[model samples]
Target: MAELAHIIPASTNGPRATEGADLTESERADPTNILVLCPTCHTMIDKGYSQYPAGELRRWKERSRRARAVAFGTPQFTSRAEARAAVEPLLGANRTVFQLYGPLDDVFDDTRADQWGRHVVDTVIPNNRTLLQLLQSNRDLLTDGEKATVDIFAIHMKQLEERHLEGNWTPGSMRFPDAMNVILKGDG
Candidate 1:
């Protein structure tokens, strides 16, 4: 179901061949140097149609390895609680964003509104971006149920950024509290 292509090409005449030269043939063939992609994606990459270059491909492969480790690595959890506890830190990063969300006032002038604008712009949005990366980069760590939760949160964060966080958002028009309640409270 997966196509394993060399991160550094097996052919010595290829672009990254020198880099792989130091590696033994077996090392060059090692799973670490390989990328598992769908057949169509594999063809695109192999045919040099992908936008990603060698370095980017390598980084993606490394992240995949890390994700796989998260899914299957040592210090195995003995219970659902233990597994949830392990990923709590990743999910908790959004706590400040949730706290700041409710204080946003779209139709009133108040200190909370001021705080909301500053906090959402200066902190929440940036934190959400990082949280997205954390969730995506370590996706394999979560169970199917947990992955669903994380994915929904990510979608909400992206939507919030696009809707209210980007650019000079009008003060009386951005009702983040109502708009992002689903994300903030995980109610949906």
Candidate 2:
């Protein structure tokens, strides 16, 4: 599991605690100063602070941020058609996975349930996140209704992530917005 590791140790009472002594309190608490590392990596970095200095850790964080931006960044599209083109592939992928292994009535068997869980984690969740990013970034192409649909979709996405990633099951979470299918298409 991923653990939040402070780039410059959060506390000053334990191992490598003194590492962030130079940073202000706000900087120490900042998201930029945290690394989402696996438990083993977190332990290694915490125990070997000299080997993983604050500057080096900060560089790693920055590199990761840049890499994610390149991999998932949405480009500006001039028209609704262009935005639709950019969004369709991810939507199709998500639909395919949902059709094959989603929590449908016919897929209630144990094996299918297992596959559904795995696909939700490995495919559905990531696709939804990327789709959300694309829609939000290309909001200029959306109609008023599409924007409203997106706001609801955002809630569904958050609950889905929390249910799967954070293991926080919330009842009565909003369903996927069907209107999202035509987002940035036709009229509002």
TM-score leader: 2
**What are the per-residue Cα lDDT tens digits for candidate 2 across 69-148?**
65777565567887788789888888888788777755458887788788889998998988888789889878878888
- Count of clashes in candidate 2: 0
Q: All models: lDDT?
A: 0.60, 0.80
Give the lowest summed-lDDT range of ten residues in model 1. Answer: 179-188
lDDT of 1 by residue, 1-188 (tens): 98777877777766456555676778777777888899988777767734556778898876777568667653333344444444445345455555755453355657667776676667677766765555455555556665666666676666667655566343434332332222222321
Question: Each candidate's TM vs. the true structure?
Answer: 0.40, 0.59
Point to the candidate with the largest lDDT.
Answer: 2
What number of clashing residue pairs does each candidate have, in the order they appear? Answer: 0, 0
Over the full model, what C-alpha lDDT does candidate 2 score relative to the true structure?
A: 0.80
Error of 1 at 178 (Å): 15
